[model samples]
Target: MEASGYLLSGVLTGLFLLGTVLVLARNRNWQHYSPAGDASGVGETVERLAGSPGTWIGGFVLLTLGLGLGTLVVVGGLPVPEGVQGAATVAMAVVVLAVLAGYVFLGVYHSVRYRGLYRSQAAAAGIWIVATLAVAGIAVMLLTAG
Candidate 1:
């Protein structure tokens, strides 16, 4: 209670509330899926966003760089005096990077193998996930830094 503070808890709670709102909005607004469940405006929007160059660039930045750095910040502690705390931080970093890399690879492969298009939508879904997580992660880190 004395060492950490309420910043982390507040950030987490805010993120959870935001997620809940998003889910609710999705269910309420985008509930017009066709009988097949695939034919919907959401699909078109996804395809469009995926095809956009911003998606690839942003995805790369967010998933690869953002998550990579964010994970280090977290595992290394909020304000890591140095690069890592101990072997544990290094090991945790390795695990996280590996998972992040694998996730990126899978998302890119899926986007290419399935969602075929002209432009490069490397990690469409992963980008969205990364963006959402990074925002919250950044918020928390910023609070901790303060």
Candidate 2:
């Protein structure tokens, strides 16, 4: 049941992130953009940011860190040791911070063309981060207390 709770929370978090990305893409007019064509200045900026290698790298890092930590908690059999809940809480806070940083990066990276999208992304990212933290908090509480 605990594992299920964690998995469910993670899935929900991912879905929210995906939705935010989709909305950002749409708002930025990047839904079907082609960087190889007649792109205006704004389009060029969009292409540069959206097609940036750094975005992909950041995404990869997020994927790796999230999976790595989750795997450690599950496979390493590191049950919430007594008094260690603080550590788990801190770690979740860090994850939330990372998510916020990523959103900021996305916004700044594309600010040249997608200012509106950046704002939307920031709002959506905040929502997702809060939701994830809430779920993770619940999971940790259950794991530690139960």
Candidate 3:
């Protein structure tokens, strides 16, 4: 059972990484599709708010750290005091929930920003939702596994 848990965590981590790459690619594509001079209204607003690729890269790094720590805990590689384990579990849960919420927000933003060209954004959002759920499930398993 413990081995299986580790395997699941590994799979979820891979999925998360893949989803992150897809999102970054999509963001780049959006920038190219609607260059500065071409964008108007919502597209322009989104382009400005999205900032540069560096912003997304920084966000990805932070996300990787959060998820990596949670994965380590889930796989029983991290030791925690009994009392503190619960707090760690809560923290992981919050992290996963925040990621899920961020994906949902991106979906909405893309829907508005891309308007007629939202299929890719929708697909990326769906992938991210699944990845976030997998991470959440892994966190729950880790918290309850003892």
Give the Cα lDDT of each candidate. 0.65, 0.66, 0.73
Backbone clash count, each prediction separately: 0, 0, 0
TM-score of model number 2: 0.28
Cα TM-score of candidate 3 = 0.41
- TM-scores for all predictions: 0.30, 0.28, 0.41
lDDT of 3 by residue, 1-146 (tens): 97788778778888898898878777753443553564457876777768878778988899899778876776677886665666667888888777777777667657655775566566666566666677678777976787
Number of the top-ranking candidate, with lDDT as the measure = 3
Runs in model 1 with CA error above 4 Å?
A: 1-39, 71-146
Local error of candidate 2 at 3, Å? Answer: 44
Expressed as tens digits, the lDDT of each residue in 1-146 for candidate 2 is 87778769768987997898788767844444334666468877877888999987997798778757755664444776645555655676677676666675555546533555455555665555556666667767876774
Error of 2 at 124 (Å): 22
For residue 123, what is the lDDT in candidate 1?
59
